[model samples]
Target chain A: MMLANKQVVLKNYVEGYPKESDFELRSSMISSHIPQGSKGLFVKNLYLACDPYMRHKMSHHISNDVPLLASFNPSSVIIGLGVAKVIKSADADFEEGDYIWGMTAWEVYTLILNTNGLFMIKYTDVPLSYYAGILGMPGLAAYIGFNNLCSAKEGDVFYVSYAAGGVGQLVGQFAEMKGCHLVGSASTDEKVHLLKSQLGFDDAFNYKQGNDLARALKRHFLKSIDVYFENVGGNMLDEVLLHMNLCGRIAVSGMISQYNLKKLDGIHNLFCHISKRLRMKGFSEFDFWHKVPEYLEFPIQLIREKKLLFVEHIAEGLAKCCINFCWYLLWAKCWKEDFSSFN
Target chain B: MMLANKQVVLKNYVEGYPKESDFELRSSMISSHIPQGSKGLFVKNLYLACDPYMRHKMSHHISNDVPLLASFNPSSVIIGLGVAKVIKSADADFEEGDYIWGMTAWEVYTLILNTNGLFMIKYTDVPLSYYAGILGMPGLAAYIGFNNLCSAKEGDVFYVSYAAGGVGQLVGQFAEMKGCHLVGSASTDEKVHLLKSQLGFDDAFNYKQGNDLARALKRHFLKSIDVYFENVGGNMLDEVLLHMNLCGRIAVSGMISQYNLKKLDGIHNLFCHISKRLRMKGFSEFDFWHKVPEYLEFPIQLIREKKLLFVEHIAEGLAKCCINFCWYLLWAKCWKEDFSSFN
Candidate 1:
């Protein structure tokens, strides 16, 4: 049997910021059944994560050395993590009618040739879309970063930049639930509003409205910040350094501000990293993979208890040019949307 | 009972790079005996460490919140750490003819009002000047930085900037003794030569001669660098960030390059800290005071075994104007002379 796969393909190598015109929607035919000896599960992508890391893939300038962030070839199907139901499986680990999440192409159906990356869905109590965000990479990143790196404690003053985004919002809620006073910053008023009112952040502000981030930080935190969950980097990291308390920890999750630039902005005042005995660690979710079983238990339970609230902007099948709009927002270093769009 | 204490005083708060005219040599009379019920040690100054941190105090712009670093009034005697012999004592912890090391003024005869800060010289068999450099603050800094923060391992590729300086030299030797391959960078050819030839660094380079530090690092460390002992920050730190391997660590002991700047040089590559899961900690010796006894044993034995070598540029009764020379070199952010000079 034949399957017609509608795919999003890179049209050319992107430069600086990716434009909508850089990608093309194409249709291709593939075998409906999993190929023999491939030991694969055929997946139909349901909810694709609109991530900033994907922007790095649209460009040819990326060095090949970076793990898990390899550039996509021109005219090739864009590979990403998404929620999908297994339609067919040559591997015994996955069966038909099973819901799963793993590396899938931005297409209607994907033949997952390598079963190594496939994660079998164990629980079906929550919305399957949650697997693409709060229960998958972004959730794991937030969990590992907050628990392992930040070492957040009750009554600790916590601040996270880009706090309205996928991982940032989760980290802020986690800190707040731990009895930490949380301050967050976002690119727009709505996101800031959602952060303070909806997501339970103690305070939220529009970073775009501030002239001096240092003064802004000083205004809110008259004393010092204990843990800084650094999602976006550049001037924010520099200013946060000045306000960090003794033995403060900075967990660098992403530098969205610096990623698209031909040259990253310079950060001064890192000397505080020494004088105050600061710990600034750059980490990925892979660092805490061994704790996955132990890590997933709490957040899943919290979601069930109605104590944890997550904010996300849902969209079905992103408009072709909107991908450029997304990349433009990434270049702008923050989103203007409610939270995020999924396709 | 009257004694004339010769002193070097800062003429006024210096702005930018200091000049030779910024200091004045003066004399003042003080009682030779300890004051009644003072519980102090009357002592003569022996050695003073010329440290970059002292430069932060010479300017009025310095914030008062910094631990243990305070500014002296114009025309007042400069205060610094020194090795001394007690001439008289009212404290039970000390007696006449006993030697000690503590924070003291930049003068020949001084009355140490706070015996609390003084450490009685138990290990006098080593040169007294060693207390000012290796066995004192700088040595303690290197020990804590290498063992506590770095967690160095055999077969690790280690790099230290300003590798012939007091703390840098010790860190490199400690790494080398740990069976790590060591690379060092210095501002001058002679210091570079001293690093590899005298201090046993596997490779050394003169940073002044190179414009491309990333290339320079790649040349020396063909593979990834495991540990970086950052003595001098700024552009060098940016470059080193590019060469760090996965799970690498950076021990930021000092940022001499930025200490005297009205504005510090911007570091652009700190994002690598995240990409590589790097741990960059800025620490001081005060954090490890409880472990002082446990930490002191191994290094003293290393010195006793002749397995460790230390570099010190000792000068006695420095001209008042030469303190400005030290300040000038501090603004330049590297050293032309060796360890220090004192009056």
Candidate 2:
């Protein structure tokens, strides 16, 4: 048996943008059995979700319970939505070797106690790792944010920001399935092509190369934007506001653009939201977890039928976890550079 | 027939903030009757509403349809919502001395030919000027912005910004009549007092005195806000975004704060709207004008029963219309010192 375990832990709460310096890989001792009378599971994390919302968790508290989904604690292992195999369990419901997916840590192994809302992943034919992402939080978010909040309809026009990112990519395909015209904005040429070609977006633009995002959106969506899935806020949101149709809808899932700045960039064109009778809503997957089974059924069937597609940028090992996390954040920020060279 | 056509005309499309310099009083020839085969009415204006939304119309092409609402021609009279008595009529529907109201010019006497959707004010026992304001466009806006957009319910905690303003003041009162607890933010001691004392608000605050509008809101509403009737935007809107409850509805009628702003203010707290699953919407009165009968009955009954109260800052005559319009804009921008004298 390995006497020592390799694990990732929180170094500190990140300020501005997240960096590798914000996480640490440390060694710890682990035991298979829980401490007496403790309701804990020895979870061996198989997959973790790197999401846009995690950037919000990296910052210190702006307000008490600032984030409605979950709050972060300093000096604790950074928690995330993950798929884990229960190696051992003291709880009555969970058993050894049960594939479980819920909130866990950015670690190789964790003795998770006080589990809230943990469930066994009974749907085994699908990729187990999807429990961490598309089949999990982001997936649920895409469904709820689009369906319940925006009340999306067939033939509506959709413009998703961070279109090549985790949730946005999925949302584009979902919109198409609903018979809506889908458009998206990515940061890289490769991502833009991936959105239009691989992800089946009607059109996609590289916001980095675009001179005026409002004008660019106008070119693609000649009629007007009916729904905007806002992932990257600030100037992008501002531009989206200007191009919205009367009675348009905006879903505020994340704001990667403002996460790094001390003073967030203000949207100058918000008044257009009023003029257009636009509906802008903020949402998280937690609120709509009740609809997971109903939501998962269609997507899972789509995946098995080879109707759905997704991309995963994976890191090699526990030793590279911190840097990989940083890479995810950097990529989300539209910073294209090989941080591996520095590492 | 007195052909002395004393009128208030737009000097030019206003740039930045509107000023008295942007409007001119024009003496023009008046036609006493509608031309043959013309569908119009000649009327004497009774009262005109000095509204903040008119400010957007004063500026050139603020958006696509802003010019239509503003009638902001270089040498044309400033037009707005008003109550009038038809003095001479060629249109089949309107008769001589018939009371009517809709969109009209800020003038003493005028000819309205080719009227579209203008209605005759049947029962004029109630204040005729109320049709120009509280019982008119502002009232319709409050009803639609709250009932239709926000879908306000009993036991809901409703919050209103610019609570002393035309629409804001009425919405808070309307919510109160529905057994909802209303909280409002004004810019002065008198306005705040009026909200709590006369309008039946549960609590009220002077936004100017409170450095942190969000904290002040939290103090007033220990529970989460269910519906937000937003008028003043900027920091106030940013703060309100933080305290909204899940599935909370926000009626974004106008963002008066950013209207005259040379550069728009940023709303940093918009991300909170998603986390809370908040549904924020922008709207105008005309969008839901078909529901006017139902809207009029509730408020009219409230006024008849003396259950709902309202206040207006009238400018007296059309010669003072340009100055009054400027004062309305100034008051919206928190330049209260100037308008305070009139109130």
Candidate 3:
């Protein structure tokens, strides 16, 4: 039997920033049955992640010229993370109707190869779309960044930047689960409420309205902040250093503020990291990918048991894909609460 | 019985930065016999340490307004870290002619009290001045920073900033002794040669002459920087972040570059920490003070066994004390490799 597929392809190489014209929507045909000796699996893509990390992948020069991140090839599909159902499979582990999720494309169907740690979503009681964000890469990032890298102890106070975003939201909740006092800074009032009320953070503030970030942190943290999960940098990171406790741990999860800027800002309070005996480590989820199987189980159980709550600002269809993607990206960058009125 | 004595004291509080006018030398009287019920001893100071950490004591503004370390009060004898020989004592553990090293005054003769963890210099066959540095606080800082904080493994590539300074010089050698490759960045060609030739580092360079720090690091360490002992911050730190290995560990010992500056330079490459899963930790020797008893014996033994080497830049005479102290404070702020040229 033959199956139909819709594909999204990159039209050309992006230079400084990505525009809507860089992507093109097209159609293709696929065979539904598995072919012998083929490791590739045909997946029906379900939920696609609109992540800030994707922003780094959108540009070629910054990604290619700098040896820091993987470069995206021109004229190829803009690859990203997605939750997909395995509709046709030739891989030994996956089969027809087997619900799995990993790094799929921004298309309706993708032929996935090299399935090293692409986990099958066995736990179906919760939202499968979570495989794209909270229960997937972002969740692993949060766990490893907070629990492992920082060595978060009970009663440790945490200040998370972008606390309402994909990884930030989960990190806040994970901090709560560890019996830590958490204060998050989001871009919107709704995110502030979501962090404090829905997510059970000790306190939260809108970084958009706060004139002085150091004062904002000091206001909520009273004594000192034990751990700082830095997702957004620029002045926010500089301010957090002043209030960090002696021997404080800062897990560098992301720095979205400086990602798009042509010239990056330098932090003034970095010297405080030495004086206070603070630890600031940068980490990514790629290293902790081995822990995904057991790691994914925790978030899935939390969602099913009603212990962990998550909010997804999802876009509906293919026509609104680029606009929805931009909306989430911008919201994630600035204060989401400020833009809630438009939503 | 009255005895002749000598002491050093601060004339007044240093305002902006320390100058020669801040201290005064005085001659007083002391008893040869230990005081009754004092469990105290009389000692002659031999060598003292002029450390950058003492600069924090010069002003009331440093240490978050706490008087943890303040320069000697006006009209009172000045105190510092010194190696002293016991002349007379009543304490059961200490006796006459016993050589000991600890936090002491900048004077010829002194009465010792509150001897907490003060031990006899068991291995003193080498220069007694070694006890003030490689066998004391600086040595312990190097050991703990490399061993405990960094979890430094064999074959790991190491980098130390302020590599000619007391602690950094030892850490570079220690890395070599541990079968790891070492590179050090110092202020002068002399220090770079000293690091490579004397201290047993694989390679070394003058960070002062390096135009692009990131390029310099890439040129030296083509592989990866496994551990970074950060004694100098600002641009050096930014470059190190860009070239750090996956799961790299950074020991935050000091940041001399931005010490006096009210506003510090920015680090643009911090986002790599997250992507690379790097570990950056800040520490002080004071936090691990409890382990001094266990720590003291190792470095003392290392120096005695000829496994460890150290150098000290001492200025003679009490008259030159203020000028000498300023030299150390300035050295801490900038790259000073020509200690011999100061005379």
Candidate 4:
């Protein structure tokens, strides 16, 4: 069967901040059935996550050499992590109606050439859209960065930048659950309030208020920060280095602030890493895909017990993809494009 | 008995590059005996090590909050790692005629008030000066950084900056002995030659020659660097980040280049840490002092086997301390003050 596949395509390589004009909505015809004898899954996109890392792929000169982060070709479909339902499958592991989440294109339907990166969504009890956020890449990123990398302990002073972002929110909760004195920085006072009130963070601050981020961090952390979940890189990272306690650990999840700029901001305080004996590591959720089964248990348990809270703004339809993504880039609340209507 | 103690004292808090004018040689009288009933060792200085970290202590505004890195007070004798002969001791662990190495003042005679940091030198077979370079703090630093931190294995591509210095030389040898493909960078062509010829590095380059360090690194590292032992921070670190392989490790032993600068060179490539899944750790030998015994065994064994080579330029008398220290800061060959004549 032939289907009209609506895709959000890259207009051209993005420079500086991405505007809606950088992306174009294009509809193309595609076969709904998987090719005979080929190991491909013809899937219907349900929810597509708008993430900061996606901005890197949009850039003409992507800095990273990682194959997983290959830059997007001009006028091609933007691919991202999303929840989809398998319409037809040539692979033995999946069949029609199987809900799965992994790397998928921003379109109504996708013929997945590689099935290895995709995973069958087991627990449908949680919101299917959550598979794109807290239950998917963002959730796993928080798990790998906070739980695996930070080595966080009770009473440790934990700080997270962009704390109201998808992964940062979860990290703050995880730190709080571990009995840490959690402090988070958000771009707006509203998000900061939500982080402290709704997410149970010990303290939260609007980072945009202060010109001196180091002094801001100092005021929040009376003792000093032991663990820092770095999301907003550049100047934020430089300032955090100054307030880190001895032997502090910083898990660099994403540098959202630097992804758009032609020149990444210089981090001058790396000397602190030596003097403070700090360990700063950069990682992606892609690296920990093998641990999906191992990681799913805790967040799933928390969601079921009503212990974990997720805040997300859902944009309806593929047409809203570009504008919502632009909003997300401006540090809007965590957003996901709802394509469930196409199903 | 009273003894005339000749000393090298800091004249003032240093700015920019340290000079002989920043230090003064003074002679003072001190009792040759340990303070009565106190746990002290009256040591006759044998050899004093001049290290890059000493430059930080000389700065008027020291950046690190580490207690072990407290800035040197103006008009006070500079304290550093040195080998000495105990002439009188009230401490039970040490006695007259015992040779030891630890934190000692730069003087002909040092009455060590705190004996806790001192360690009794066991092997007298090697030159006593080896205790200041090869078998002392630099040796332990290389051990902790390379063996303990890098998780280096055979065939791994390893690179070390300041490869002919006290610590970098040992790290290069360690990488070579591990059967890794080792490359190193030094400031001078002479030091680069010493690294390849005397130090057994697979490839060595003079980082000072080419303005394009990234190109220089790429030329040396065909397969990219898996382990980077960082000594020269600043732009070298920024360049090396671009050439790192997947899952690379960087052990930040010291940032010699930034020690004297009022504003550290901005590191613009830290984002590579995420793309490469790199682990960059900053550490000091002070943190692992408890493991000194364990660390000493490996380097001492290597020295005994005649497999390890150490290059040191020794200056006789405490009067030469300031000049030698200034030379050492200029990336001159590792220098030690020989105070044995005072015994």
Candidate 5:
């Protein structure tokens, strides 16, 4: 049997900031039936996630350090995390009508040759779209960075950049639960308000409003930052170095601000690392995937009790995902995007 | 009785590279007798240490992160680590003929009001001048950075910058002792030869010979660096980041190259910290002073057994000390200086 599959493919390798024209929406015919003697699953992508790391995949040369994050070939479907339902399964681990989430392509239907990356969606009580953001890779990223890397403690003055973004929003909430003094920085006033009022951030600010990031940080972080969740890097990191308390920890999750630039911004205040006895570590969520079972318990309980809040924007189709992704990179709101309602 | 004390004092706060005229030598009259009812030590200064950190103290504004490292006040006697013989004592802990080493003024005769910082000479078999370099702050700094912070182990690929300097030389030796495959970088061919031939490093390169630091590092570090003992920070650090292997650790002891500049050079390859899952920490020897007793055992045995070697250049008299220090900063040789034979 054959099925018509709609996909968002890379038109060309992006240089600097990406444009919507860099991606193309096309339809192709894919086999709906699983071939005999091959253990594979044919999946119908339900909820696709738009994330910052996907931008790196669009580039021609990706760093060899992250072997799992491979670059996207021209005319190939954009690869990302998505929630999908197994349509036809030859693998014993997955069955028809079962919902799963993992690395998938930006298409209505996907032939998942490697099922090892896929995870069976155990909890159907929560919205399946939630698996694309709050309960998926973004949630896991926040858990590893804040808990495993930063070692956030009570009374710690925690500061996070891109506070309204998928991982940042969750880190701020985790800081609040740990009894830390939480402060978050966003690009817009709306995101700042959302961070403080809805996301449980102690205080939030619009970074674009002030040219002086040092003064802004000094004003909000009266006691100085003890833990910093770094999502955006550049001058922001340089200024944060000056305001960090002695022995501060910075968890480098992503450098969204530098990802699009041909030349990365140079950080000038690294001397603070020596003077302040500071420690900075860079990591990815994939590094701590083994801890997923241990991590799921904490967030799942808080989410059920309404103690945690997540923000997201849902786009309806494969074509809209490309437009929404471009917008997502430009206007870095603290909300994750779920490309749902795919036909 | 009165004594003519010849002292070296700071003329003004230094702007760039320090000039010999920045220090002024003057004669003052001081009582040889310890004042009655005062717990003080009247001592004759024997040896003073010329160190890179003293350049920071010469500046008007120093980072408040290191409270112990305060800036110099104009017209005040330069304070530094020195060895002295007690001429007179008003304290019960010290006697008239005891030999001690601690923070002292750059003068022939000094009245130390606080004797708490002073340490009595325990081992007499070692050269008294050795207390100024190998057995002093630099030695302790190397021990703490390589052993405690870097967690260096056998078969590790260890790299050290400014490997002929006071701290760098010792760190290279420690790395060698730990059975690590050591590679060291120095400024001159002579220093590079000394690092490889005399210091037991597996490989040594003259960084000044090559304009491309990345290529120099790549040529030497074929297996990539597992641990880096960083002394000079600037372009060297930026290049080193590119060649670091997965889970690499950088122990930042100092940034000597940036100390003299009004504006520090910016580091651009920080993204490698994340992709490589690297960890970088900055610290001073003072932070781990409590572990001194435990650290002393390892190096002392090595020195006594002729397993470890130290390098130094001795400059006689207080007046020549100022000239030698100016030269030391410009031509950063791997040798420590002892301003002995003061009159």
Candidate 6:
């Protein structure tokens, strides 16, 4: 069967903060039917994750030898993590109507040539959209960043930056459940409320309130942070460095604040490392790939019991992909009730 | 017997760059004889070590809970590591004229009340002043930071900042001896020449030439650094961060650039850690206390063989102590013939 695919394409390599104009939504034709004996799976894309990390891929930024995270080759579809349904498959491992998640483009349909990176969905009990977030790469990162890397102990003073967002919410709740005194920062009052009231954080603050970040950190966490999960780099990281306790661990999951800039902001006051004896480490889901099976059971069970909470913002339609993505780069999420609904 | 002892005392807590007036020279008197049955050792200070780490201890820099590295109690003699000879002793472990190295105040005569931190000077074939740099705290730090922490391989592309100073000089020679491709940075042309000619660094640069540090690093190494020995921790460290290779290791030995400042200079390019899979660890000599005996044999033998070279800077009097200490803070040692006379 022949089908029309609506896709998002990169017009040129992004310069600074990406606008909707950088991405072009174009119509293309594809044959939905797989060739006989071809080991390919034809998928109908459902929920595509609008991750801030995708911003790094939009720019051709790096020294000559350093590898790009994701290279957005012009005229090709912009690919990202997505939850999709296998409509037809000539691959023996996949069956029709089976749900799977992997690198799918921001489009209605995808013909996956190689299933090497794809994961077969075994459970249908949870929401399919969750595979794009809490049960997927972000979930694994949240687990490993706190438990394995941070080595967070009970009674540890834990701090999370970008605390009400995708990974931070899960990290706060999980570390809080582990008997930590959790303090987190968000950009808005509503998100702070969600963090403190709904997400099991001990305390939360709106960083945009125009208070000094270091002073606010000192006020909230009296003894300074023992374990810091650093998702937002730049000034947030700079302030966190000041309050980090001796021998403190910083698990660097993302630098969303630094990623979109033309000239990345400088982190002054790194001198704290000498006196405080801080350990700052950058990590990704690739580091924790082995722990997925072991890490999955606890969060999935907690969610089932309604003991674990998560705030998800979903955008419908592939055409809205560019518009929804622009929000992350601008970092202007108002965190209104409509933007994030907790379950 | 009464003996006159001259000592250098901290006049007041230093504000920014320490001055000669920050330390006052005063005559003190003590019994030249040891007290009967009292556990004390009376020593004549020989070569006192001048190190950059002392800058942190001069002021009240830490929070209440955090431990002070060393507090410079006002009107008291400034204390640091020194090579001394015992003139008298009441302890059964020592007799008259036994050489030792440990913490001794800036004075010609010191009565050591406790010898817990002292190490017996076993061999004296080398210069007695050798204990000040190549065989003391600086040497131990250089050994452990690279061997124990960095796990530096033979062919690794190694970079050292503040490369002509105490620890960096030793680290460069040892790593070069290990057959690593080494590049180093110093603050003067003479120091850069010494790094290339005397210390055996493959290439070296004077950072004070005001070239863009990141570009200079790229030109020298050709590839991103695999191991970074960070002694200077301002913009140079920030620049090194940009050119670090994947799975790069940075041994945070000292931030000499940060210590004396009321506000540490900003490290702007710390954003490079995320993509490079960098591991930056801050360490000190205390971390390698156990490795001293096992590690000492290697470098001491190299020194004996004349294969390992180290530069020594000597300040003659307790009065010259304050003046010489300023060079490390200003980072202005010309590294000319007078600064290092070792062949």
Instruction: Return the top candidate by lDDT.
Output: 4
Q: Which stretches of candidate 2 lie over 4 Å from their true place?
A: A1-3, A36-39, A66-71, A210-212, A332-343, B62-71, B210-224, B245-247, B332-343
Clashes of each: 2, 7, 11, 0, 3, 0
Question: Which prediction has more favorable DockQ, 3 or 4?
Answer: 4
Q: Arrange candidates by DockQ, descending.
A: 4, 1, 5, 2, 6, 3
- Against the true structure, candidate 4 reaches a TM-score of 0.95
Residue-level lDDT tens digits of model 6 in B137-209: 8888898887866768889999999888889999998788788999999877878888898889999998867
What is the two-chain DockQ of model 3?
Answer: 0.58
Candidate closest to the true structure, highest DockQ: 4
Which CAPRI category fits model 1? high
Off by over 4 Å in 6: A33-38, A62-68, A287-298, A337-340, B31-38, B59-71, B287-291, B337-343
lDDT of 2: 0.78
Off by over 4 Å in 3: A1-37, A61-68, A332-343, B1-18, B21-42, B60-78, B87-90, B210-212, B332-343
lDDT digits (tens) for residues A1-343 of candidate 5: 8999899999999887788899999988998877778898999999999998888778877455577556778888998899999999999998999999998989999988888768888888778988888889899999889877898899999999998888999999989999999999998777787888888988999887767777787788878889999999998999999989989999999899988888899988898888888999999887776776677677777788889988777877789899988887776542322212211
Could you give candidate 4's per-residue lDDT for residues A6-68 as a string of tens digits?
999999989988899999999789997776768999999999998888888888754446877
Chain B TM-score (model 3 vs. true structure): 0.87
lDDT, candidate 1, equals 0.80
**lDDT (CA) per prediction:** 0.80, 0.78, 0.76, 0.87, 0.85, 0.81
Considering only N, C-alpha and C atoms within 3 Å, which residue pairs clash in candidate 5? A164-A334, A165-A334, B164-B334
Give the DockQ-based CAPRI class for model 3.
medium
Off by over 4 Å in 5: A332-343, B33-38, B62-65, B332-343
lDDT of 4 by residue, B1-343 (tens): 9998899999998888888899999989989776677899899999999888999989865454687787888899999989999999988889899999999989999989999879999989899999898889998898889877899999999999888788999999988999999998877666776788788998999875767787787788889889999998999899899888988999999999888899999999888888888899999988888888887777777788879988877887788888888877865333212212221
Q: Give the TM-score of candidate 3.
A: 0.89
The TM-score values for the models, in the order shown, are 0.94, 0.93, 0.89, 0.95, 0.95, 0.92
Model 5 per-residue lDDT at A247: 91
TM-score (chain B only), all candidates = 0.92, 0.92, 0.87, 0.94, 0.94, 0.94
Q: Which one wins by DockQ: 2 or 3?
A: 2
Q: Which DockQ values do the candidates obtain, in the order shown?
A: 0.81, 0.70, 0.58, 0.82, 0.80, 0.59
